[model samples]
Target: MAEGKMLEEKLFSKHLNEEMEVIIYLPKQYSPLYKYPLFIIQDGKDYIRFGKLPKLVDELTGSAQIQKSIFAFLPYKTVEDRRKKYHPDGEQNEAYIRFLAHELVPFLENLIPSFQMAGSRFLMGDSLGASVSLKACLKYPYTFGNAVLHSPFVNDDLMELVKQANPGMLKIFHIIGDQETEVETTNHTIDNFLAPNEALHNLIQEKGFESEFHLFEGGHRWTYWQPFLKPSLKYMLPAHTFDLESMES
Candidate 1:
C-alpha cells in the first residue's frame, strides 16, 4: 500500500472573501532539486480517497511511465458549498475562478518553489467539478495549460466557451460513459452526459486541440473513472519515453 504523503494547507482568499482547504499529495521521492508538474483536482477528497489517486500516482511513477507530479485537491465545505463554487452559474463562480488563478497558483508557487512554469499546471475534476476545471482553464488559458474532465455537467454556456477558446493554448483529456444518459448534476437534476460530452468532443476535434476523448463502458461514477486514471495520466503527461511492446509484454 505504497502512497504519496498528504499535507493540508489553509488559505484565506480575498477573491472569494473566504478561507478554503487544500490537500496536497507529494510523491514518494519529492525533492526541492527538480521542478514537477502540478495537478489540481476539484472535489479533492473524493479523488484522494475514492479515486485511489495516491496509490495510482505511486504505481505510475514507480513504473517510470508517467511524470512524478504533485497532486492538490480542493474540497468544498458541503454539497451546497460545492454547488456554489463549482457550478458555472453559481454565485461564487467568478470569485472561485479568480481564487484558482489569482490566489491558489501564487500560493503553490511560493510554497513549493520547485514547480515548473505555468504550462506544467493541470486542472482535473469529475462531474460538476469537471465543468469547473474546464471553465477555470478556459477563463485563464495562459495560467493552466491542461485539463482532465470526467463526465462533466455541460450546458450551453460551457459549449459556447469551448467553441470560442483557442485550442492551441490548452490540452484536454475527456472521458464519458456510454450509459451516462441520466447523470445527476449539482442541482440534483438528471441530464444526458453522453450527448454533451460527444458534442464537446466534436467541438474539440473541430477546434484542432491536442486532446483525447474516450467513451468508456460504465456510467458516471468512480467505477469507470478509477480504471481510466492511469491511461489519462499517460496520455496527458508521459514522464519517460514509454515502450508499448514492453508494456504489452
Candidate 2:
C-alpha cells in the first residue's frame, strides 16, 4: 500500500485567512527523486472518507495504473459555513479560488519536491463542490489542469463559468446521473441537470478541449458517486497508471 497521510489545520498562509485539513496519498515508492502531479478535491471529508476515494487510489496505485502524485482534500472553513463559501455568487468564492491557486499550490510545492504547473494539477468535487471544480479550472487554467465534476449543480451560473472557460492546459470529466431531478433544494427537473451539462460539452467541443461527459442511470447522491470514483481518479490521473506499474516492481 502507498503511504496515506491525514493532516489537519495546515495553514496555507495566515494572511490569506485560509487553513486546510488535507488527506494526502503518497505513492508506494514515493521519493524526493521526482516532481509530482497534484490532485485537489472539495467536500474534502466526503471524498476522503465517505466516498472511499482514497481506497480507489490505493488500489490503482498498487496496480501501477497511474503516475505517482499528491492527493489533497482541502478542508472547509467549517461545515456550517459551506454554503457561503461554495455557492457561485457566494461572498467567499473569490477568496476560495485564490486560496487554491495562491496559497494551497505553494503550500504543496514546498512539501512535494516535484510539483509542476503544466499538465499536472487537478480539482474535483461532488454537488456544489463540483461546481467550484469547474469554476476553479475556468478561472485558473494555468493553476489547475484537470477537473472532475460529479452531479454538479449546472445552472445559469455554471453556464456562465463554461462560457468563460479557456480550454488551454485543462481537461475535464463531467458526469451526472440520470436521476438528478429534485425538490431536493429547489424545484428542478432532470432536464435541468442534463441541459447545462450538454451545453458545457458543446462549449468544450467548440473550444477544442479534451473532455468527456457521462450520464449514469441513478440519482444525485453519494451512492452513485462512490462507484464512479475509481474511474474518475484513473481518467484524470494518467500518471498514476504508470506509477502503479512501477510500484509492483
Candidate 3:
C-alpha cells in the first residue's frame, strides 16, 4: 500500500474570528516539483475518521486509478460551530463561505505547491457539510470548479442560489439515499433529505451544469457514502496519462 504523509496545521481566520484546525494529506509520491490538485472537505475530521479518505486516496493513486492530489480536511471546533458555519441560516454561514474561498484557498496554495487554478480545486462534504461546500462553490465560482455532495441538507434558499448561478462555471457530483425521508438533524428534528436533494438535482440539471446525480439504495449515513467516494474521485480527478517510451528515451 502507498503511504501518504498527514500533517496537522492551524490557520487563524479573520472572518470567523477563530483558529481553524486543518488536516492535510500529501500523496505517497508527493513532490514539490510537481503541481497537484487540491481537494477540500468540510466536516474534515469525520471524513478522515469515518470515511477512510486517506486510505482510499492511497489505493486509487497507487493503482493509477486516479490522480495523486492533496486533500485538506477542515474540522469544526464544536457541534454548535459546525451548525453555525455549515447551515445556510446559521450566523456564521456567510463568513465561513468567505473563509473557504478567500482565506483558506490562498493559505493552502501558498503553503503547498498546487495548480493554483479553479479547475484544480474540489469541494466535498456530507449532509450539512455538503450544504456549505456547495454554497462556497456557488458564491465563488472562479475559485472552485467541482463539488461532491453526499446527501446535502438543501432548502429553498440554497435552491434559489443554484437557480441564479452560472452552471457553466461548475461541475457537480451529487448523491442522496432513497431512504433518507426522515433523517434526524442536529436541531433535534426529523427532516426529509431525499425530496429536497431530488429537487436540487432537478434544478442543477435545469440550470445546465455539468453534473451527475444518483439516488442510492441507502440512508443518511457513512455506510452508504463511503462506497461512492472512489467512483466520485475517479470521475473528478482521473489519473494522468504518460508516455513511458518517450520518457525512457
Candidate 4:
C-alpha cells in the first residue's frame, strides 16, 4: 500500500485562549486538486499511537475499502485539560465545542482542499472525547454532519441534548462494549458505560437520525475501540468515485 503523510502542527484557539496540537494525515493518493472529506478525531495522540488510525486509513484507502480523506487529530495538553474540554460538565466544555465548530473546521478547510459541505465533515472520539464530539455535532450540525463514538461517556445533559436535537441533521456511528458495565472513570468512580450507551442508542433511534449502534464484546479501553475503527470509517465514509476530469475543469 502507498504511504500517507503525517504532519504535526499547532492551532491557536481563541475560545480556549491556547494553542492546541493537531496531527494531520493526508491519504497516500491525496491531491490538492480534488476536494476530499475530513475526519476530526479527539484524543489525537492515543488514536495515532494506540488506535493505529493512520495505518488503518492507509490500508483502507489504498485498497478502496473506504474513501480517501483527510484526518485531523486534536490532542489535549494534559489529562486535566482533557477533562475540562471533553467532559460534559467540565469548565471548558462549551468553549471547546465552539472551537471545534467555529475555529478548527474553518482553519482546516482554508489550509487544505476539503469538501465544504456539512455532509463531508465528521467527528470521532472515545469516552469523554466521544461525548464532546457528540455535543459539538448537536450544537453545530451545520458544520458537522457525522460522529463516530466508541464507548462515549454519556450523561443526562448529553441525553437531553440528543433529545432536543433535530433528527436527520446528523449521522452517527456508535459502539459500546457489552462488558462495560463496570468501567472506571477518570474521576475515580465506577460507571456502567453499557446501560447509558444503550439508552443513548435507543434515543438516537427514536429521534430518527441516520445512525448505527453496536455492542462489542470487550470493555472501554483502546483494545475494543481500535478494532472498531475500520468498520466505523467504512460505515461513515463509503468510497466515492471521483470525477477528476470534471473537477479540474
Candidate 5:
C-alpha cells in the first residue's frame, strides 16, 4: 500500500481567539519541485482515523485516478466548539470562516512554497462541517473555488446565501442520503436532513452552478460517506491529464 505522513501542527487564530490543530497529509511520493493542489477536510481527526482518508488518497494518487495533492485536515476542539464554528448562526461562525479564508490558507501557502494556484484549493466536510465548507466557499468564493459537502445542515439563511451565490465563482460536489429523514442535531433535535438537502440540490441546479448532487441509500454516518469520498474527489478535482499507462509501468 502506498503510504503518507501526517504532520500535526497548531495555529493560533486571532479571529476565534484560540489555538486550533491542523493535520496535514503529505503523500509518500510528494516532491517539493511540483506544485500541488490543496484539499482541506474539516473534522480532521475523524477523517484521518474513521474515514481512512490518507489510505484512500494514497491509493487514488498511486493509481493515477486523481492528482497527487496536499490534504489539510482541520479538527475542532470539542463538539460544542465544532457547533460554534461550523453552524451558520453560531456566535463564532463569521470569525471561523474568516480564519479559514485569510489565516489558514496563507499559513499553508507560506509553509510550502510549492503549493500553488488559489483556484486549486478545495474544502470538504460532512454534516455541520459540510455546512461550514459551503458557507465559507459561498462567502469567500475567490479563495475556495471547489467544495465537497456531505449531508450539510441547511436552513432558510443558508438557502438565501445559496440563492445569492454567484455560481460562476464556485464548483460544488454535494450528496445526501434518502435515509436521513430524522437525523439528530447537535442540540438533540431531530431534523429531516433529506428535505433541506434536496431543496439545496434543486437550488444549485436552478442557479446553474458547476455542481453534482447525488442521493445515496444510507444515513448521515462516516461509513456511508466514506464510500463516496473517492468519487467526489475525482469529480471535483479530476486528473484528466494524468498519464495512467506511464505511471503504472
Candidate 6:
C-alpha cells in the first residue's frame, strides 16, 4: 500500500505530431511471463492525486481483491491546452485518441504483452477526463469493454456517441454528486455537476449496456472519488477466483 514499487512518467514521442507524456503504475505482482490488463486514465495527474490509484492497487492486490493490472496515466497539458485536448472538441482531441488507440497502446503492448486489446482494459477519467473515456469507449467498443466515469462533463456530441455504441460491448460505472452546480464549468453558462451525468447514466442504461449510476450526498470533489475508487477497480478488474475466506484459514 505504500505507493507500490515505483511510479513513473515518461514522454511518449510519436512520429506524427507531438510528444505525449504517460504515467505508468506497476503493481508489485506485475510479471513478464504474463500479460496484464490496462486501465488508461486521462487527466492523469488528477487521478494520481485524487485516487491515489497506485497505492490502492498495492493494497487491494496485496489482499486479493483483484488481480495485478496496469494504470496508463496520461498527463495532458495545463490551462487552455488541457481543455482543448481533453474536451470532446479540443483541437488535439483526435490526435490524442490516435496516440492511445494507434500508437501508445501498441507500443506499450509490445513492451508488456498483458496490455492487450480493450477487453482486457478499462478507460477512466474524472469530469472531462470522464467524457473522453466515454468517447474512447464508443470509438473502440470492442477494444474497451469497460469504463469508470466520475462526474463526467457531458455534452451533445458525447451524447450522440453514447447513443451510437453497441450496447453489448460497453459496460459503464458512472457516479455524480447530489449538490453539483454551475460553478464547476468554464463557460459559467451551464451547471454540469449532476443533471448531465444523471442523464447520461439513464441514457446508457436505456441503450442496454450493463451500467450503474450512483449519486452520493456530496459536491464535485476528489474526497468523494477516493473512497469509491476501490469499487471501481473491483468492477473494472474482476478477481479471477475469490473466496469467502482466505486459503490460510
Per-residue lDDT over 155-245 for candidate 5, one digit per residue giving the tens place of the 0 to 100 score: 8999999999998998999999999999999989999999999999999999999998889999989889998898997897678744323
lDDT of 3 at 105: 92
Compute the lDDT for candidate 6: 0.76
lDDT for model 3 comes to 0.90
Against the true structure, candidate 6 reaches a TM-score of 0.89
User: Which stretches of model 4 miss by more than 4 angstroms?
Assistant: 241-249
Tens-digit per-residue lDDT, 136-200, candidate 1: 99999989989999989888999999999998988999999999999777677888889988999
**Candidate number with greatest TM-score:** 4
Across 34-126, the per-residue lDDT of candidate 4 in tens digits comes to 888899999998998999999999999878888888999998788888999999999999999999988999988887887687788999999
Instruction: State the lDDT of candidate 6 residue by residue for 63-135, as single tens digits.
Output: 8888777788887677566777678888877767666677777766665656455677788988878887888
Pick by lDDT: 1 or 4, better one = 4
Candidate 6: where are CA atoms >4 Å away? Answer: 1-3, 7-16, 187-190, 241-249
- Give the Å error, residue 160, model 3: 0.8
Go through the candidates in order and give each one's C-alpha lDDT: 0.86, 0.72, 0.90, 0.89, 0.86, 0.76
Off by over 4 Å in 1: 241-249
* Model 2 regions more than 4 Å off: 1-3, 12-18, 77-79, 186-191, 239-249
Clashing pairs in 6: 35-114, 36-114, 118-143, 182-191
